[model samples]
Target: MATKTKITIQDIAEKLNITASTVSRALNNNPRISEETRKAVLKAAKQLNYQPNNIAAALRNGKSHIIGVIVPTADRTFFASVVRGIEEIANKLNYKVIICQTYDSYEKEVQTIDALLSARVDGIIASIGKNTENFSHYKKVLASGLPLVLFDRTTDQLDVSQVGINDYLASYKIVEHLIKEGCTRIAHFTSPKKISIFRERLRGYTDALQDNGIPFDENLVISSNLQLEGGRQSMEKLFEAGELPDAIFSASDYGAMGAMQVLKERGVAIPDRVALAGFSNEPFTSFTDPPLTTVDQLSLTMGNITAELFFEQFKLKDKKFVPQRTVLMPEIIIRKSSLKKG
Candidate 1:
């Protein structure tokens, strides 16, 4: 279908019995326009469905006034909330946001960056894909002199602004909580250790076990993609060792949900025969039959800070601002899955 013609200032002016120039000036909030005329023009513009031409305005200012946001997926609550936070800040600053999902593919992440660059976005906020070992695509953003900010999943190889929770400390707290619950044999469902975030989490898990005087059993750990199916498969692999873990700490809520499904099928009662906990505090965690215990990584706040970092660069202009890394602490949410409740 063809697009409908957009209503313009002239269309609104015609409806308001005024000149197009007067309507334009009023819409732009020029001081020359009387308050009464401004109100009338705005009301008429709303009635006529007139939309401002941001592209024309951006051309005049030599800035797109649009921020490019890249994430693994919007299907997850954590990423969606981050987008929400970006939009909130973008709106307040009169900047628009365009989001791109890489779906956890390195190739697709490259494509998204190219597309955003083609669109001439003022800056970019990104959470890298799991498979992204190469950093050239991100380096290109710096080469172009565009401010780039990373969030959640980032790398040490590239020096860029980033915001995320302290995954190592968060994982340590998770394992410690399970130990306090009398769970000695604790299994872990984790992503590949190649990624810096996962590496920190895995490190925390092993350190926590060692600190608590529990032997670090590699057989009890399974690599997961942080997907629901991956969780189920990890559970099976953990049980194949001829020793069942009394508790499980999954790197993601989706993985924990998958473990729950498999356990329920095998007639295993949660927090009784086995306890469970997950990361990221996904929305569905609380809705499960037994609410899942999780660590809240402050996704929304991370996004807000990520966008603010981009604006901060604009303010500095000339002075060098060293690559900033903001790591927020994770908030542990206690629920039925991690606790033995009556």
Candidate 2:
């Protein structure tokens, strides 16, 4: 059997009775090409089954026209929403996205970054992994002169553009809401990891308590991975240690749900016995028995803004670039779980 002949721009140009250079410019959507010519070129290329050589084009243009997006996990709604937002903007700019999941592992995060860099993506947008304490790998990205944008789980150690919700204020709003619902002894669930978001949430919890004239109790603060199982274990230990709180404000919705499960099993009434609130407003929060109160991180908006920021980096590439931080305000979703009063 004879090998199939590969189609090229020259073939499209020959069919259209135009120059191959004009065909190339039209295919690239170059502004210099007239709309009518571009349309004819595209129609002819499609009829001829022309396949674009992205690699060759990248080599000629010195850009891959691809962006790498790193996240802790895509299973969660928050990350998925953000990635969708990123894609919406990226596709409009004729750019493609390569998504990598770290699964909250530091080693995996580092390896993912290296892989993205090796792939020669134009830039990277990432949310730092939970266990990523070392900023060396992220710094390496900067050292290579690649644009980096961090979202949600970002650190100040790297002077890179970042986009995220105001975690501190979000936590504060939730805790303050619980206090307004007559919650006095509130327990906080957070990760022990040095992740900045968790730290900010913790600060918010503490400050809210102090500002509301409620004494902060170290014993009421439980540090863990903030996963469902961690929330269960933390609640169990708190009960075992006789540290029952009047209210619970977890940094993550999963943790709050875990505690809710245990509370229900133990015959403890929500809001009546223990007001519960959490962050991130996971979808399941509303389906729970009493419905959960949570903070909305504006995940979709964060994703769109992150992608926009990534594109903005290209504008400043030729100049002295200063990193910009975009912080989105959070919304508190009040529900039966934390609404004890009118």
Candidate 3:
């Protein structure tokens, strides 16, 4: 192993036959330094690949210039898009992002939050995990006077700024659409209703049926983990009972895809014998056999808005900035999967 030589501002000053203070001011582009001198210093610094010590700069500025994000899983398409949106806004503001995944575990979610706080992030944007019931950990973060914003899977119990789609209304609309397509026997595939998003969506599904003069059948609703295999197994059970629904409204695209595969194997023709609709217009939705008719949650916009909300709170502490809970309307993408009536 060879040792690498350390380069310093003094070296550049000595090489340029200029004082260290002049070199520093020029490198920083201080107004006192001439443009020509600043450009020369910048070019030299770039040629040397000089890297500033951000840690020292952060300490001096009393902020880390970094935003932390905690999500259930980074691999999911929705979360990945949200992260990209957050990164875009943060980059524009000369900030960086640190991301952590909870894997749907409440304990891991708390641990990630603690680690982010210890890292001294300027602010945090998070979507609570599936297993999260107690929000004391989040309350602790708020108590510490750090700016925090929740998105996607936020709780109404807590009075925090949030950005997400109107899950309840979106679900209601999708179910109503299925009803209008002449689907009398409709089933719902969703996770447990303990979480706010799932609860609201389930309510919407049931409400739409009741309001439209359709009897709400508990037997038609299947509670499953928001996973592909769960969807497959649940659909298999529904078939085994000899009461398969003519249509299904799934809470997630992954689950709907799984159900579609199982239904196709059993000779059930989509939009003919059975129809399917899902939430979160994931990329794979378009590539599916008939293209999924799903809800577009606008994950990227939600991420950008969440980041902007955090920054707003940080910048306008004394101006009575009201905590905003923004609920963006979801768009229903009508494709072959749910287009039953021409």
Regions of candidate 2 where Cα sits further than 4 Å from its true position: 1-53
Model 2 earns a TM-score of 0.86
lDDT for model 1:
0.88
Residue-by-residue lDDT tens digits, candidate 3, 69-148: 99999999999999999888889998899999999999999998888887778878999998999999998888888888
Comparing 1 and 2 by lDDT, which wins? 2
Can you give the lDDT of residue 273 in candidate 3? 82
TM-score of decoy 3: 0.86
Error at 35, model 2, angstroms = 16
Q: Supply the global lDDT for candidate 3.
A: 0.88
> Which structure is stronger by TM-score: 1 or 3?
3
- Per-model C-alpha lDDT, please? 0.88, 0.91, 0.88
How well does candidate 2 score on lDDT at residue 287? Answer: 94
